[model samples]
Target: MPQTPHIAFIGAGNMAQAIIKGMLAAGYPPNKICASGRTQAKLDQLTADTGIHTSIDNLSLCDQADVIVLGVKPHMMGDLVKSIAPAIDPSKHLIVSVAAGILAGSIDSWLGQTTPIVRCMPNTPSLVGKGAAGLFATTGVSSAQKHTASTIMQSVGLALWVETEAHIDAVTAVSGSGPAYYFLMMEAMIAGAEELGLSNDVAQQLVLQTAVGAAQMAQESQQTPAQLRLAVTSPKGTTEQAIDTFNKGDFSQLCSQAMAAAHHRSKELANLYKA
Candidate 1:
């Protein structure tokens, strides 16, 4: 890898933009970054905003990039890889994919060779630089390439590696789809607050702050989440009543079922790429 590798993003959507912002903030030279997209307007917008090279030509961009980020949707991945496969040098370039459920083997197959492929699942929170991402790389990826991939991901937020490609599906269930679950809970809380006569604005602010504070506390505290919950739940107190209600309704089981469904769906989506 070059001292400062040239990284190109294949799609200029929200995730790609977030990564670019993080990379720039981390002192990655804008000249070494390039992005390609289908829309000329969006390409122009990205170039104007970040001062990075942007174009609609995906195949040509691959030749100038040492690390190529496949930020396009999962359904478009196969065709996109095949389209640029001829331009990519498998021995020199590293492919990092943020598209969910697509496997490294499938990407290699599409590329027509054993290219160094890193599969990443990053959540919506990446937009705010508080995201959690899970990554899995093929055997062809070198330690230095892995470091480059890690640097890009860690720029936005937490980046962890899974032992197997199958674990990427679990990450999708937990962290990838996890934000929506939190949003649902927040929505219920806000609705309940409004039902109890609080104004919409007040209820939303209260719930959002509570969510943020609780998460901060959980991160700062040395105790486990259950321990922290117990610490707050006094004997026969309001918190205890709420806990009892959740337990009686089998909330934990419900959470498990929901995550299981997400995991199943993730696996199902990957099957779309199977021949």
Candidate 2:
């Protein structure tokens, strides 16, 4: 394993906090981490939660840490990168951006062409150490640097490395926005259950636990999801009824449509950033 470089997050918001907690869970000492944002109250809470240093000065944070994570919003990304560019030493420091719409090229353009940049799209489940991250490294980033980025991301959940940055939009569609898709499914299930005369809590318990158990089964068993779905659906039973309804409603098309919409939006955001 490569040396775990000192890590610093430029924003101490919810996403940054999730990463911080995940890092700690992965055995990074509080002393090895630092976080900075404009809000001192948030920073103070971060310092209290983890022994990592906290600051409102991005430049100072940049100067000290070996791996800098840009956890700010996309709109503020350009300014943050520009301010920390001078503090960044390309040879020793690696920049990992978690801002959704900012690209690796943009980070390099704002800092310097040679800046080792990695773009990561992380989801909300990170707070619970179950996020799926989409990661891609720019041309100059080393193999060691790429693994380091993977390690940082996988500390939360799963991290996938795409062959090209273009595929990240697809990633943004699938796993990046996947949690919300599941949430919406749960909402619909709950509502349907309520309509069927089950108490809200009981209905949610059935659907939610089924979701969890199904995921766990897929993870633990050698069987595929299709096999598992078949295993659950009995001949002309309730499960089959539900499956028939879903098929008739073209649930697969709905999924495709939703993913396409998200992908299109991601492209638009990237275009906006370039503008």
Candidate 3:
């Protein structure tokens, strides 16, 4: 196995901390993982929790890191990259950004023309070590660098690469914003159950377990989702009635529209940080 690179996170917020914890759990050495934050309090918390090095000096962290993860906010990314550009070694350092709406071109401009940049969109589920992330790499990145970046993201969950940066927006709409969509659906299901006389606790348990089991089955089954759905639907059964009501409400179209809106917003946000 290839030796794991030293991973440094520029932001020590929840997402950064989640990845750091995941890396440690995945057997990356504690000494090889470090994070920098703007606040002493957050840095202290990270150190106390992970036993990894933490600091308020971003530039210093970059100097020692083999793979640097930019976990800062979209608005702050430009300035942060610029500030640490001097410490970045294009030949040795790999840059991975988890900030939304920040494109690889803009990041390369802020850092260096030859900087190996990988743009990633990882969702909130990463906190629980079950995230789904989409990555897009710039021309400057080598295959080794790509693998390193993938390993870091996979430490928390699934990491997939997109052929073009444009597809990252579609990913942002799907897995990036997907958890909230499921949460909303579960909320409605639980509320409907309560209205239909199920106790609150019972409804919550049923809906939560159903979601878990459904996802597990979908993953384990050889059949596609459509095939699985057809298998579940019997002739004029109770499931069929619920499906009919959803179809009448144009559920599929509604979901498509929602994802399209998210894709559009992602583009708009990226434009805001154009170089």
Candidate 4:
């Protein structure tokens, strides 16, 4: 087997930690992984838990890593990239940014080098190894580097590449903010069930299970979600009545509008963080 590349995470936050845990679970060597963060205690905890190297010295981490994951906040990305720029060898190092709204070009500019950069939009579910992420790579990235980036993200969940960077915003609208959308629906369902006389605990449990089952069915079945919904909705039945009520309230349109709003906001954030 090929040796795993040295991967370094620049920020040891929840997302970074999730990716690290996922990689470890997937059998990536602990000795090949390292992380750095602002808080010594957190880095100490990560080191203790994962057996990966941890430190507050970001530059040293970059020097030793073949793939550098920029896990800092968007506002901190510029300075962080600049600080480690001197340590990066563009020919050998691949930069993977999980920071939202930070563009690949901006990172390159900050580094003052023609770097191979992969910008990834990974969701919170990544923490649980069920994430969906959209990745966009700059022209400088080699095919091999792209594969490496995809493999790293896939350790946590589903990873797909977008044809253009703009589509990443659409991805953000879909998967990045999508978990909250589902959570909101779950909340509404639980409330409705309680109003219909189900106890809170029962309602919560049933709603969560229903969500899990629905998602699993959608994943495993050959039928599309629409087809599955129609299959479950018999003529003049309870499911049909519920579907009718949702349609009456223009649920589909509302969902579209909400996603569009999220997409627009994603662009706004990108612009806000641009150098």
Flag regions of model 4 displaced more than 4 Å.
1-3
> Which residue window of length 10 is worst by lDDT in model 4?
1-10
Q: Compared with the true structure, what per-residue lDDT tens digits does model 4 show for residues 1-275? A: 12478999999999999999999999989999999998998889898899999999988888889999999999999998889989989888999999889988888889998899999999999999999999999998888888889989999999999999999999999999999999999999999999999999999999999999999999999999999999999999999999999999999999999999999999999999887
Which scores greater on TM-score, model 1 or model 2? 1
lDDT of each: 0.93, 0.87, 0.92, 0.94
| Model 4 residue 210 lDDT score | 100
Cα RMSD, each candidate: 0.8, 1.5, 1.4, 1.2
Q: Write the per-residue lDDT of candidate 2 for residues 144-255, one digit (tens) a residue.
A: 8888898889888999898898888888999889999999999998999999999999999999998898788999999898998999899999999999999999999999
TM-score of each: 0.98, 0.96, 0.97, 0.98
Ranking by TM-score: 1, 4, 3, 2
Off-target runs (Cα >4 Å) in candidate 3 are none
